[model samples]
Target: MSYKQILYNTPPTDAINPSLTTTDGTFRLSTIPKPSNVPADKLLVRVHYLSLDPAMRQWLTAKRSYIAPVELGAIMRGQSIAQIITVGSELSSKFKSGDWVVAYSGWTEYALLSAKEVEPFSVPAGGRPTDAMSVLGMTGLTAYFGMTEVGKTKVGDTVVVSGAAGATGSVAGQIARIQGAKRVIGLAGSKDKCEFLVKELGFDAAVNYKDADWKKQLKEATPEYIDVFFDNTGGEILDACLARANRDARFVICGAISQYNTSKPKGPASFMTVISQRVTMKGFIVFDYAKQYASAVQELGSWLAQGKLKRKEHIVPGGIEGAPQALVDLYKGVNTGKMMVEVAPVSEALPSKSKL
Candidate 1:
């Protein structure tokens, strides 16, 4: 049978305009043959949702990094929620057909993935398996590890989160509160996001960075020094947080979305603060804590079950064809929470119910 796929045919040059430039090319829908001979360790899956992450922009570059860049003519890489439709004979009993799973399925309707490359997940009561792609998935794990390990968040400490309304930042700020933070401050782009952070997500205070007096607001919100700063958008916000950091404060740099698209990256102007306060700023990749992912998932899942932690997803409807635009929207900060693309209707494999 034939299926639709989005191949990364274009590369971003000056700025990513998927419609006009190949620097980040537009989605190309194509028909491809199904795998006839299934390998013993491989499985066939039908993708339901595709994660739209800021990291995808970096993946398009040919520069050397921790992970290999996505090559031209290849499927755009993304984590997806899928269902195992066919399993190899050797793995039939281990993983049967119709099993929900999470995998690096890329931008396609159907995927032939290695069993080892995918992880099986159970749908929680009153929740769908798509939660595995959001709060209880890589995004959650990134927050859990970054806050606990790198940030070293402690009780009674004042915590601050940049990109506070976004996926990982929202979770990080909430987790800090649960861990006994004295105050949790969130910095977001718009008034609505700031309101969501303070009113809906239970943040102590929020600052709208787009406002002219945002710096004054940040100082007022964080009267005392910030103990932990979970930075997702590293730019002036990072510098501001650094200036107000307490002695030996911890800075967990998970992402620098503000600088991802820029040609000449700018460092924080308050570089002196790093030495003056003797702060501990560290950058991390989620894969570093892979061994303890299960423990973190169990804890985060429990929070979701008890309604202690909340999650929101900004789902863009359209299959592989919409993948390109969804990515652009993510960079533009149009998505409120976790940005995702609906590759197919989840109603077929699993219904979208109360999500994590």
Candidate 2:
């Protein structure tokens, strides 16, 4: 039997903007032999869904970052949901062949993963197992920590979220509302996305950053100015949020996707406002709060069950063959919410084991 995998064949041209490109040889897909013998304390997993995130592009860069970059000719790094096909005798007491887990399994159809390297997860109420990759997953955890720990959102504070239609930003805005923000405004890229943010996601208002009058709309949406800014799209939107920041505002720098694709990286030009407004600006990674993930997931899960939180996802199908296109589409902002690719379909019709 053969299993497919995607490899890192070409590093990006620049370090800062390591966006995925279709230029020949950027990524290569190949078939490899299936594992014939699984080792003890290890499980053979069939990959199901592979998360497509903006940060995946950044991981290609060899720059000094929170984490190391993927090496040349190595498997592309990604978080995925996989089903156990077979488990080692040492691990059989704790796990079964049908059990599901989320792991940093990279871009492969089947992998031999140790139990310690993956986490067993169950679907939260109002969330699917796939949510372990999206709203109820690391993205949700990022929003939770970015809002409560870093952004310090408070009741009646006016909040603003950039890239609000994306996975992290969308949940960040709603969590702001759940935190009792008086007004929650979002910055999205399209009119439909703005509408989705305001109508479906329950944001107080949403501004289309692509609109010519975006600044005006942002101003109109937050008349009292922003007390907390959860910034994802950094360049221009970061500057705009700074200009509208109220006194004693907090800026949680979760990501800077806007500048990711550019040749020259840019910073917010409105630093002066940070001084004038007595702002508290900081950047944080969710890994820093790893210890509290379980508790945070509990609270986020409750909100999701109570309808205080919402998420959207764009999943590209076609098995491993669709992985490259999914990354390309994600960078183009072609996905409205959490973007991912289906490596193998989750099947429920199997006799005892399903969800490959």
Give me the candidate number with maximum lDDT.
1
The C-alpha TM-scores of every prediction are: 0.95, 0.94
lDDT string, candidate 1, 8-117, tens digits = 77777635665523444544556799888777888999998998887888898889876899987888898998888888888987887878889888988998888777
lDDT, residue 58, model 2:
80
lDDT against the true structure, per candidate, is 0.86, 0.85
- Candidate 2 residue lDDT tens string, 11-38: 7664322223454556787789998999
Model 1: how far is 16 from its true place, Å? 2.3
TM-score of 1: 0.95
